[model samples]
Target: MKKISKVFFITLFLVVIAVALGVAFPEKFETITGNIKSFVATSFGWYYMLLLSALVILAIFFAVSPYGRIRLGKDHERPDFSTASWVAMLFSAGMGIGLVFYGAAEPLFHYMSNAPLAEEGSNKAFKQGLSYAYFHWGLHVWAMYGVTALSLAFFQFRKDEPGLISSTLKPLFGDKMNGPLGVLIDVLAVFATVFGVATSLGFGAVQINGGLSHLFGFDVGFTSQFIIISIVTILFLISAWSGLSKGIKYLSNANMVLAVILLIVVLVVGPTLLILNMFTETFGLYFQHIIQMSFRTAPLEGDNRGWLDSWTIFYWAWWISWAPFVGMFIARISRGRTIRQFITGVLILPTLIVSIWFAAFGTTAGNVQNSGVDLTQYATELVLFNMFDQLPLSIVLSIVAILLIGSFFITSADSATFVLGMQSTNGSLEPPNTVKVVWGIAQSAVALILLYVGGLAAIQNTIIIAALPFSFVMILMVIALFRALNKEIR
Candidate 1:
């Protein structure tokens, strides 16, 4: 009891209380959260861009530096899982639900609405559509993950630091890291993780509910989403209770398998040649535009030029917000790997998977559009399922997609609860059951309330706002990581 971090506990308690109040007064909470999100966008959206660019630059330097030869653990230690299992866990941790959630919707949205200077529906817009999708989901997002994961893994395994985000920066501040500032970083991390996972769960519920409507004639509304999120919350709590090596691993591997199966089916049934071609072409174009896109921001052009905020900035913020949870989970499973190996696997493999997944699904969606099917009428959550509806064996495929999503939802939630427990319990690798269940319940409740109160679109707003502060923390992490690594090498 005495070892518990009072700062972590108090921060979580305040977060829970605020969320409870939000649930009690839905409109006011939405208004408050909305104002904050808007402020983050209007004021600091460019900061997210600049900060993300810096993080990516730093990650690339670390990967190619001589310091990359350093092992995450002792020289003799090796990875806990096989290569395949490790990659599966990485995908599950990084963005399993996100791929399924945005794979189809984003491409179409980008195709249709090019804001500010975008000539809407132009051939150029279509080109930008695929490029932007690849851009947002590509190396930079993974690099952000790489920054935090490498830092945490290096410090925890090599320096004997605790498995906390704050401790990763101990190199920058020395003993001051053990004081209030360190606690603040970890507290912000916990807060961001809670909302980040909750936002994902909330949007994922929209997908699940949308699937239910497409398959079974259920209506897509708050009640159905609430029930879906509740059932999902319970399953993940049970998984969290089962501990990491068992339930979480089994589900993640299973999800990777199922998700792969779905992608393969789409490739075979849909336009295989076009999908492959788009992937190749987009691969080049993605690299071509990667630099321009990284620093791409709207010129305070007009009232409607906020598209960058809605898409790119939103993505960067969301990815940063998820860095703490994803980074910690990756570090936990990533012991015994070299820094170079970790960065390559973390940055390259997942980016490849994302490209192939989007190529498979996005090509199919394009084919559907070519057949004169207008997909934009369906809700964003329903977009992927709608595209699946037109494919052969739609029912079976949609069911599989939903199950994959549910598995993702479970893995993300369970891992988050585990991380939350660890963060609150003085960085214990194995947190208490009480802490896990409490966090599990609180996470579920926040998702449900956000859904019933603000609907699907509201999900990312809170996360974008929560992620803003953590963006700075992540930069500090990268700086601190390099300083420590350089010292070790010298």
Candidate 2:
């Protein structure tokens, strides 16, 4: 009985146009997007850093202030899912394949190649590298998602508005949200979600191919990545057809179990003492330097500035790009919780889990490098598996990692399809299966096109570009959210 709205056609048209351009003129598409990406990073890098820091502050204030008492829905409405399931689902969707893709790779990259401040390959670099990884994947990123989700949940559940991004701004804009401006806002959200999720799907496909190549000596290239995406697309489509409770919920729970098993294995076999020490020290370091790191945009021309643009700026943009999809999905699962409960769970707990995860995998990879093995020599996708090859039960560890990545990939793609369907169908709770299927295929097609055009560079370039306009949209959301909350409590 559900009907697709105009937003569906408009967004789909935009996506088709983009995919066609990429397919027909791959080089030109890559060059143009890369130029724009560079301009954004160079020109507005400070804006991103400042905005993300402010959002982190706002998130903390909402959690601890009296506003914390406000429930997302009516006071008597209880959460539909239990605490554990809620946490599992959000964590799986929020950081999923990125954690596995970068767990071992990022920290090692910093120590050997970049290291924000420290000299490459030094003891200081080794220690500082893990701290940088923590910074990139920590509270600042979550604050973006937290603020977006809070606004959506507040308006949609609390104020009985349509579950659309523009709906959150109704207080300031009034019925104008019912017109073209609202359509533009919704269209932007859908566009950002499509690109953001497609980029992650590309990562999943590339990493899966890397794992297969590392294990079975399969060739690594676009062709292999194509096959991987093809197989996974079918799997996630089947899961999508199964609906949220049956497909996504089960997959999310299974992801946590598999991820934990992999973590324990790495901790037991790789470098337990170093991991424990590194985690304790890096946890303190990350909090201690959190303020400085939040606003650290290197102005002077050098490697530090390049590192900031490449890693920090890119991550901020990537998180913003994902805000629409992850935020709405979180809001959908997060009714009946207090503002404090939602913020704490969304911002704090996952940060801790990921910090530990990075500590275990990163420190092990670093230790292996220190022991005379250069993990940097391997491709980013192959780094985790190669790092495992240096440890005990290497084959078992590699197999488990690939499985975990596969499950996380499926969970993320499945969740994105549901979110996209909801966004396109006027915020319906149960979007039609046909709409979901169209989105599933569309997401995969974007991933494939991006891979075909410029691989990882193209993905990062498109993410930075797609996220910029939405960053402004998020600012409006925060202003609208605060206005609504103040009026309610008054």
Candidate 3:
């Protein structure tokens, strides 16, 4: 309590007021949030697309430019963690549950229902679906994160500033960052992180409940999801209490292992040849059209424009909202690396790995649907488990997925509490246990409240709305980073 900064109290108060409003007027809450979300997506859709495209370009330039030689810390400093452990922790913290949640469902949606640019249920739609999944989960998503994390690491580790998002802007704002403006910036960051992570937690709970209901005789309702969230909340709070090193590290490693196992199993047990073929083809397709997809606004096509709003714009906002939490966590683990090394590791490596994961899952799901199975009939949360029903060792796959989602849930929530604690406690590397525990509970409560209000739709709407303000903060960070780097070189 003593070590906690005013940001904690202010953000917590805001969160409490939000939860109260959500509970008191659930329908109104849903309607207002949905309307705001639509407006942002419609009006600023081009902005989201352009900003993300610029970030991707900037990330590549940083990796290849002379500035690449700059180290995040002292030139003599070696990395704090092994490359393997560092990748595991960052990947787990960055996009663990999302990969599992949407691995099959998203591609399936595009292939069978609504694709970005192709006719539904056509061969072109099939190829375009996997390619679009790669587009959403690949380079652009990571660039948003890589750029944010790079700014934080360079400022905090090399420039010896406190580990806060606002600190990165000190070059542009100077001592003004220490005043009320800085507090406002940090509050927006904390607010975005809370909702961003809470939405992921909500997805985890829903999918876990979906898996359980598919396996056993359980109901897939708010009641089951409530229990799932409660149990995982307890598990993650315990991990949060154990501090950063022991709990998050081990859980992250477990998440990677489980994820790999599931990926391999799906590849082997499902359409192995098709998965391989699709991976090769989609890999080429994604790279070939990467620029077009990056800047795509679908201005002339009304249907394509709507698709862009629902999927591409929504995902851009989602990654932006998640940038603060994931960026900070990546920076904490990525000490003492050169700017080139950091950008390559963050942008390229993960992009390739996620491409492979989606190829295997998406190809397999598409194959199942092509064989006369109606996967589109099922809800999104249940689609993955239902797809497993067509594969050999279905029970085994479902069990592994459930366990994997649970582990990812704990890792993500635990890491978020740590990040939230850091943001709110004046960027303490090791914030107080009381602060972490409170944040742990607050995020879980937010997940539960959003679930009660309108399920996944409510969560998505809130994320898009929350991300709009912080998106401007990210622009300032990029300018500040370039300013500081120029000064260092001179």
Candidate 4:
């Protein structure tokens, strides 16, 4: 305790207590978190949208301006990983399970209802649904990741500061970056990360278990979910111990390959032309309505505005919760790259892949519904597997999906622990193996506890509630990055 930072100990202590309370008193905890989630979304949703939009605009300005020429590290530094591997790691870590989880469900939910601003059950409504999918998983979210990475990378690699959230704020806080406020910032980051990662792991574990049940007629309950968490925890810990070069890098590379294989299989096996046409149509519709979507809010109709809070606002908060962990991991691997390159790589490629991914999977699912499949009968947890049933060899494909989510689960948790270890240890580039393992365990423990307590919704609502404060931290981060960049390049 003496050797370690206050940020690590205090954050971990608080997380354990919260998880213990949640486990010891599950119903009360769920009620409290659900209320908090609603309160935050109802009251401060504009903040989430405004800040996220600012990040998207900020990234674009930074990329197109002459400042784009600036490298994240030293002047002569070169990229650490090949482009393909780098993009792979970026998508695998940044989006993780959430992307695949929401691919179909989100769009279908939107399609089931008319947009507050669009016609229902018409072509406009269809476009609105697909557009909502792209919007939720679009450039704005990546802007959060890109800008955070830029600040941390620029400060740590170029300016020689500790690679912590507080370090990026030195331009504003000066010596206070090393003071109590700094500790608080790091503590908030750790707190949010713990719950955020757990929420994701909880989601993946439940979904994977559902797939297992669907594929092999196995039981789906706490027992199976706990085993999934335990297996993933151990696997990711070993990968975390193995470090970035061998375990994470190789897993990320393989993740991309597997993702592509599954994608091609889906495209070929599903409605190929429909998928392609949907991609083209949705991509255009999303862009045309991008400005409207970015600033969209409904204050008049109670139900209309309430809908936005549930879907759009919740998504914004979710991405903000995730940005820090993903930002740090991307920054760690993205040494020796230019600001333009890094921002574009972080922003464009993943968003494109997501667009294509949704088009392939989501379009197929929606088309199947149009053919009188009654997909709405399936529960949300079972929706993806049910979507696969529309194509050939669903059992085989379901197994592949389970494999994909399982690997993605391990890879995401592994990368997050690597970053968390660094944050807790004064942002060491090479955090100790022991520290990495412990952080890995803490992450898994939170996930397992949440799953045991109330399954997916409990963890989901809790993470959204946790992100409210951290969203402010990211807003500060954007300001800090702008100040740091202005000073460095000038």
Best candidate per lDDT, number? Answer: 3
Tens digit of per-residue lDDT, candidate 3, span 1-490: 2378889999999999999999999999999999999999998999999999999999999999988999999989989888888899999998989999999999989999878788999988988999999999999999999999999999999998988999999999899999899999999999999999999999999999989989997998899988999999899989988877899999999998999999999988889999999999988999999988988888784657778888999999999999999999999989899999999999977998999999999998999999999999998889999999999999999999999999999999999999999999998889888999899999999999999999999999999999999999999999999999998888
Q: Which wins on TM-score, candidate 1 or candidate 2? A: 2
Global lDDT for candidate 4? Answer: 0.85
lDDT winner, 1 or 3: 3
Q: What stretches of model 2 exceed 4 Å from their correct place?
A: none
Question: What's the ranking of the predictions by lDDT, best on top?
Answer: 3, 2, 4, 1
Off by over 4 Å in 1: 1-3, 115-118, 300-304
Report model 1's TM-score to 2 decimal places: 0.96
lDDT of each: 0.84, 0.92, 0.93, 0.85
How many clashes does the backbone of model 3 have?
0
Where does candidate 2 have its weakest 10-residue lDDT segment?
295-304
Cα lDDT for residue 196, candidate 2: 97
Q: Candidate 2 lDDT (Cα, whole model)?
A: 0.92
**What is the TM-score (0 to 1) of candidate 2?**
0.99
User: How high is each candidate's TM-score?
Assistant: 0.96, 0.99, 0.99, 0.97
Error of 2 at 12 (Å): 0.5
Q: Model 1 — which ten-residue stretch has the worst lDDT? A: 114-123
lDDT of 2 at 197: 92
- Model 2, 105-209: lDDT tens per residue? 999999999688889999888888888888899999888899999999989899888788889989889999989999899999999999999989999899989
